[model samples]
Target: MTVMELSNLSVTLRRRDVIRDVSLSVGKGEFIGLIGPNGAGKTTLMRAALGLIPFVGNSSLAAMPLAERAMAVAWMPQQREIAWPVTVETLVMLGRTPHVGALASPTDHDRSQVDAAIRWMGLDDMRQRAATRLSGGEQARVLIARALAQDTPFVMADEPVAGLDPAHQISTMQTFARLAEQGKSSLVSLHDLGLAARHCTRLVLMSEGRLIADGCPAHVLTPERLAEVFGISAWYQDTEQGPVCQPLEVIR
Candidate 1:
């Protein structure tokens, strides 16, 4: 089943187009990676999909209208420096916002989901710690836990591993892979080419408001395409571990 659909979608910022004529259909349990250079409309496309920005064209989540799509789609933006002193558990609980009533308090079920998410993200020990006190990697996991607590069938994460170390980065990627295998469609924007190629089942490459490539890692992420779209000389090879990408040098 199609979990998310965007057709002829266009988004503009400051009167300039950021995403244009982009269309995609994401199926259930699919793990997709959105990749591009900085300011390549990867984040813009994600924002449009989540209805966070004004977009021209059609976008639907589970065939529902934009306003009603929140019930089924959950989003976690790039991790930023959060100042609030809320506890880690409380922060994850915020994911329940879409499910709870405006005036109602969290029920036992809500608490259960929050606990489960914390455990799922391996954050059980830090449940009572202040969110602002955790390390960069821990905070990233906490945010992901919040998204999991949302329990939506689909999730969209923008730069989900911006500041983490290599170990944490790979761990988080594996977590997303497991989530997709468990019947949740997950779309993640990643700048690390090798990580995206290694983990994502499908790749969506965008640039200058255009969908440049979309296919399996081997077919779409070629040296020619990387040089053309990413402006870098690179090569992708297979090893015993998995696919590896080496950026030779700047093409210029």
Candidate 2:
């Protein structure tokens, strides 16, 4: 089954087109990595999929119309300046809001899910800590936990590991892979070509608000294609760890 489908998707902000004529279909249990340079409309496409932005095209989730898309899709944006001093556990519990009744308190099942999400993200030690006090990497994981608590069929992440160290980045990618293995579809936007190649089942490359390539990472992330889109002279080689992207220098 197609978990998410976008047809002729277009998004404009203040009359400037950010995404144009984009169409893609993500199947159930597929882990797709969207790679693009800054200002390439990766986030805009994600927002359109979530029905957060007004667009001219059609998008649907699980064969349902776009009206109820958010219920079936969970989104984790790039960590921003969050001033709220809520506990990590409490923050994750917020993911249950979409599933709860209006003005109702969280039930035991919700709390248990939150707890499991914390453990899934390896944040059991920081469950009671304030979100504002955690390190950047820790905060990213906490946000991911919150998204996981949603228990949606399709998950979308914007730069899920943008600020994390190498170890944490790998951990987060592995977590996403596990989720996909469990039959959940995940669409993640990433800047790390090597990590995306190693983790994602498919790659979607975008540039200038347009999708340039969509296929297996090994075939899509060639040096010539990377240079054409990213303006970086790079060589891609397969190693024991997976495909490694080596950027030799900037191609001016």
Against the reference, the lDDT scores of all candidates come to 0.88, 0.87
* lDDT (10s digit) by residue, model 2, range 9-92: 999999899999999999988999999888989999998877777888888753455336557888898755557999999899
Model 1: residues >4 Å from true position, as ranges? 62-67, 79-83, 103-105
For candidate 1, lDDT tens digit of each residue in 1-252? Answer: 988899999998999999989999999999999999898998889888777788988888534664467778888988466679899989999999888888999999999999988987788899999999998888988998998899888889999888888887898888889889999889999889999888898999998999999988887789889999888988798778777876778985
Could you give me the TM-score of model 1 versus the true structure?
Answer: 0.92
lDDT: worst 10-residue window of model 2: 61-70
lDDT of model 2 at residue 69?
A: 58
The C-alpha stretches of model 2 lying farther than 4 A from their native spots are 61-67
Estimate the overall C-alpha local distance difference test score of candidate 1: 0.88
